[model samples]
Target: MHAKPSYTEAQLIELLKLKNQRAYNYLYDNYSAAIYGVICKVVGDEDEAADVMQEAFIRIWRNIEQYNADKGRLFTWMLNVARNLAIDYIRSAQSRKSSKTESLTESTPLGAPGYTDAIKIDHVGLNAVLDKLTVEQKKIIDMAYFQGYTQEEIAEELDMPLGTVKTRARAALMKLKHLFV
Candidate 1:
């Protein structure tokens, strides 16, 4: 097997700063598959993962100047962008799914993708507030929201009493409301 050409991270950064097409090509060739794998794992949708991969690259290109070598490696910065985009995609997709379910039986025509018009809270900030909750509260909320688990399923999976699960979930939501609103 032939050996692959190697470029140092600093060199790649310099090339990227100059908007070199070859540099962009090299970056994608080396990292796109790995980044896409991460997106797929988080979003669980191949199409959405592909979209997030493209968006992450666009963001990297646009924000190249914002990267700080003193802070960490170039790959670290790229990974952070990819992860954040994937999380945002998952959250947005879930909210859309819920809204669609809610509007399905209404006599009036469903509004055209009104998710963007819904309450606009910063996801990272919300996650921070969630971090402040008790571990059990946080776990239930994550199961219910991120994993799309029903209360019954959560109770069964956690081996907790159904009423206790319901109570904790309600308490978690109330805490989130206070933290977010």
Candidate 2:
């Protein structure tokens, strides 16, 4: 097989901005696995993850001109796109309805092999960082960041006041900051 093409980030961004198909192909070839991994973590279902992955790529291709190198790297932007799509997918009414069925199907019969997700938070030490927070703090951070819930949405979903949600989110962030430091 021919060696895959490689381009520096700058060169790839330039080519992508120029709408070069080869550059798009290279970006997908190199980054799809990482993007899919993020999507899988957010969606937790392989079929839905694959669907979200397609939507993410389409979004990236359509919005390539909107990407600003001054803000962040290409992969980071693409990851956010994929991750947001996955979160959105999970929050959709269709996903909620299907999840009811999926949950039932997901359970293994007795003696069946256990299934593990493709991505593990502990592998990247996110679990360790999260473990430092209280349950209430962790719930706020997980819903706000990982699950892509707005503070208002989280409040409504959890039946808590918006102020309480905001307070917990801020406290969670403060605790997380200490962990990084």
Candidate 3:
């Protein structure tokens, strides 16, 4: 059996306030295994528990300043964060699973009218405006919004610097906004 940790909750809180790595590591050493066990109990997978455990600690570290002695105990706050993260992860996995099932099985026709019909563009006018844009701008905007590529992903895919990709995307969006307005 391992020896019990010597640091008091107040001492650990002070170390955390100072952003001391040793204090953080000590907290992790003392608490992470227990937290991971709780997460595994909820999530039923070691991998998911590990991931949620990391996320929980990250959130705890980031929000250390928000912790209050008067509100509750430190361990209580930490456990709450862990449990919440595990629950959120499970819910997100379920949502993704349902979305995949819907996508695979649903049979919405191509000509189906979605709710945004009032905002729908005339194909000819939309094509004309799109033709006015530079190819680089068009490609970046299409990938970023329509295809859901993040700015960094777009930059890496296009072999361009990340800042250039962001600037071009913003400019393209501005141009599109002006056209729509």
The model with the greatest lDDT is: 2
Candidates in order have lDDT scores of 0.72, 0.75, 0.71
Deviating ranges (above 4 Å) for candidate 1: 1-5, 99-181
Ordered list by lDDT, greatest first: 2, 1, 3
Cα error, residue 6 of model 2, in Å, equals 5.7
- lDDT over C-alpha atoms for residue 85 of model 2: 83
User: Per-residue lDDT for 98-164 in model 1, tens only?
Assistant: 6523322221122212223222463455447746788778778655543455778788777999999
Candidate maximizing TM-score: 2
Model 3, C-alpha of 87: deviation from truth (Å): 0.5
Q: What is the TM-score of each candidate against the true structure?
A: 0.54, 0.69, 0.51
Query: How do these models rank on TM-score, best leading?
Result: 2, 1, 3
For model 2, how does the per-residue alpha-carbon lDDT over 153-178 read when each residue is reduced to its tens digit? 77876689999888888888988888
Residue 24's lDDT within candidate 2 is 90
Question: Per-residue alpha-carbon lDDT of model 3 for 31-97, expressed as tens digits?
Answer: 8766775576456567767888889999999999999989999998888788778766765775767
Candidate 3 segments whose C-alpha is farther than 4 A from its true place: 1-5, 98-181
RMSD of 1: 13.8
